[model samples]
Target: MRPVASVSFDDLLRAHQGMIRAFLRRLCRNDALADDLAQDAFLIAHQRLGDLRDTGAAKSWLFQIAYNVYAGHARKHARRRELFEAQNGADLDDAAQPAPAGMARDIAMAMDQLPADVRACVLMCLSYGMSHSEASKASGLPLGTVKSHIKRGTEKLRAFLHAYQQA
Candidate 1:
């Protein structure tokens, strides 16, 4: 198979847009924000295409860029939340938008209840179908850590949902 260098970046974008959007949407749980991030990813990919030497790694490379964008966005929001909490003694969850109704919504809510790191792994693996190594590259986390997070996250989600169901 040819490296990603062999394909036009536009062609790459056309081919991967839906998958990228689905990955972001599942991660963000917001369609508009996911679309925005997908656009951001493509723009970043376009700018940095010259830097990548291995065309075969294009998909993973793009995912890593998207993950970086998401991480930056999350950090910015975290800072804002910290400032707000310091000022008003407000909990972050107080401002969280409610989850929508349905099985997906229920699962999303369960995911939300997990620790952040574990939630990231679970979503990357199960929700977005990213393999452990792929999730590791995209998250800047060690492979073992990604594996452990997915394991721990699975246990936690199962427990949480079982409890939620009994209620």
Candidate 2:
């Protein structure tokens, strides 16, 4: 395997930025916030590039960093989130950018129903096409837990979008 030093960080950023931002957007349900978090994640990844063991695994490594960054933000803002929810009578998802219609809307709603960790797992696997093991690594979830989250999250989405299936 090539060391991370073999692949320039700029190349990595160019290749993975869109996917990483999309993953963050789905997790946070906010476009602007996702952009900010993605930038932060990339910044951290650049700072820690020396720590990456293999260039081939950069995507997963970046994902892991992004997930951790998001988690940190969530933890740091937990009380603020609660206050916002209390005042707005809605979760942050409700305050996110306007969602698309039809199945997209349904999927977003269903995803919102998932716990953050489960949602992260599901997005990493289904949305980004990461393998279960890759998702496990990225999410810092046990392999079995990542598998379970994907299964259950898929089931929930399927159930929620069942009407679309019939239509």
Candidate 3:
């Protein structure tokens, strides 16, 4: 078999850094942690570049690596709640940083109330500007299921916002 061509890691990072950061942020809900995880994803990508057969599929391959890293981090995190608690204590003051504010906070709270599947669908579609098919693939849901979740999630968000306005 022909050896894989050497790919420029810098070029790959420049092309996909923002997408990786945003995806990690959505998955983890912590900007600093997301940045760290995104970097880790890139490191993994660089290490495994030889395994990549199709340069055109780099985006999907990178994301799959990111998803795996995020999943592993989450699993390890769950196994070490005490470590998280200690970190949480250290970061309590940082938590007081001015929140999203006003309508944005309201919307975020409403979104937080959604079922996980619905929330993922809404964020992938609205935040990331992904089409239903793309969101479905990213979220690991069926296309129809992703569409339904987005529709229902949006309706719930609107109702919550409307009720909040009236109160």
On TM-score, who's better, 2 or 3?
2
TM-score of each: 0.77, 0.92, 0.66
lDDT of 2: 0.88
Question: lDDT scores for all predictions?
Answer: 0.78, 0.88, 0.74
What would the TM-score be for candidate 1 when compared with the true structure?
0.77
Candidate 2 C-alpha lDDT tens digits along 40-85: 9999998998888898889899999999999999999889989998
- Each model's number of backbone clashes? 5, 0, 0
Report the C-alpha lDDT of model 3 over 1-167, residue by residue, as the tens digit: 33347557787899989988877766566778878899999999989887777666566667667777877787687646556568675432124234678887877668767865677678767876667876666556689998999999999988997899899
Give the per-residue lDDT of model 1 (tens digit) for 68-120: 88778778788876888999896453443445798767887777677666777
Assess candidate 2 and give its TM-score to the true structure.
0.92
- Lowest summed lDDT across 10 adjacent residues in model 2 is found at 90-99
Regions of model 3 farther than 4 Å from truth: 1-7, 50-61, 82-98, 115-117, 164-167
Clashes of 1: 5
